[model samples]
Target: MSRVRIFGIGSSSGDDQAGWLTIDALLAAGLQCDDAMVIEKLDRPGANLIPLLDNTAWVILVDAMQGSGPAGRIQRFDQKDWPRYTKGLSTHGFGVIDALSLARELGRLPSRIDLYRIEIGSANPGEQAGDDIQAAAQQLARCIAADLIATLLQA
Candidate 1:
């Protein structure tokens, strides 16, 4: 059995509808907590992300990305393709590369780490993103869910 874990690193207050859409997508894809899992942060920062990563064979993260690229553009990443990132990859407290590196060092990382990232045009200075960004993030969530289903069917 393939154990798939999906983590939304931020909260609804910060992530807004993107967080809920992620949960919906997974369930809509007919995936249960037994086959997959989600971390919806309600009152904390970086909540439950580590524990979720610890038990899975594969982790597909859906996060809102900030860039000059077109909105709703979806991109993917694996450990093999992750670049040596600098100061500005994610708006979250921890950089994406650093988070993955920390998980790896702590032996909490999954065997396969895939990122389904969406590029956004604008975002709020704080935790929450702008409306356009949030919409794109939701679309990316759906795409990731579909990708997950396709992967399972192929396997």
Candidate 2:
């Protein structure tokens, strides 16, 4: 089982690509992942995400979100904060909260789960992510990298 797993979830649409871009940024930043650590990008995994959460000690999920905030605004959510932030929000169809709730019910959830959302202004098909979204992805990648380093040290 992997000790740490980071998943970037999104689609190919405009701002929806924020999660994938964050994964790209993380890779470009040269955050090395040994066998104990797994990093991947998933295209709107939804309920499919539940299976990936199995047997992981720590999990971090990144996705694009549409909120009142400006595009590229980043929000971090812990497991306890899901209820407050995820109401009536569905990314494509099924959402992270739904998958996570199922995982928790099935006893497959990791002890530590962190969710990072990048606010998006649009998800128009085939368009590239905006400059602001790209910048936020890079910033979030750096933050996540630092957090991973600290977690690894403590472990």
Candidate 3:
């Protein structure tokens, strides 16, 4: 039934790899789930993201955000609370916020949407994530994996 779907969005650049790294960590942690769970990694999906949420009961999106803070800090926002936190904040003119707004308007937004934004130190191409960001990605992935399991059990 695809009860839970997680989409990690990022490019291959420096700290932008947070989303991909989190997905890698989840796999390394040996997250076990039934066919009801789906995980994907995307590189600036843009408008292609809308259709992916169709019929999913819950959606968790992990991405990197450039903000005034030490890298690797984690912040979570729900579908309804995001606009308040990221007004006009779009990376490359299009990003999660735009995608979510489109989905909401089209009535394709999932019943539950969780956005995990990881503070990135830099997004310079070819650069790797700093130590702190790497560590945080691993920790966040583990936490999300555990939550997915608990949610699945309740279903």
Compute the lDDT for candidate 3.
Answer: 0.84
Which tens-of-lDDT digit does each residue in 1-155 have in candidate 2?
Answer: 88989999999999999999999999898976787988899998878999999889999999898887889989898888898667524456788888998999999999899998999988999899999999999999999999998988987
Q: Can you write out model 1's per-residue Cα lDDT over 51-110, one digit (the tens) per residue?
A: 657767777776655565665566677776667223225656655566677777888788
Instruction: Kindly indicate the candidate among 1 and 3 with the higher TM-score.
Output: 3
Tell me which residue pairs clash in candidate 3: none
**What C-alpha lDDT, on a 0 to 100 scale, does residue 3 get in candidate 1?**
77
Q: Order the numbered candidates by lDDT, best leading.
A: 2, 3, 1
What's every prediction's RMSD, in angstroms? Answer: 3.9, 1.2, 1.7
Best by TM-score: 2
TM-score of each: 0.69, 0.96, 0.92
- Candidate 1 global CA lDDT score: 0.59
Q: Best candidate per lDDT, number?
A: 2
**By summed lDDT, which 10 consecutive residues of candidate 1 come out lowest?**
39-48
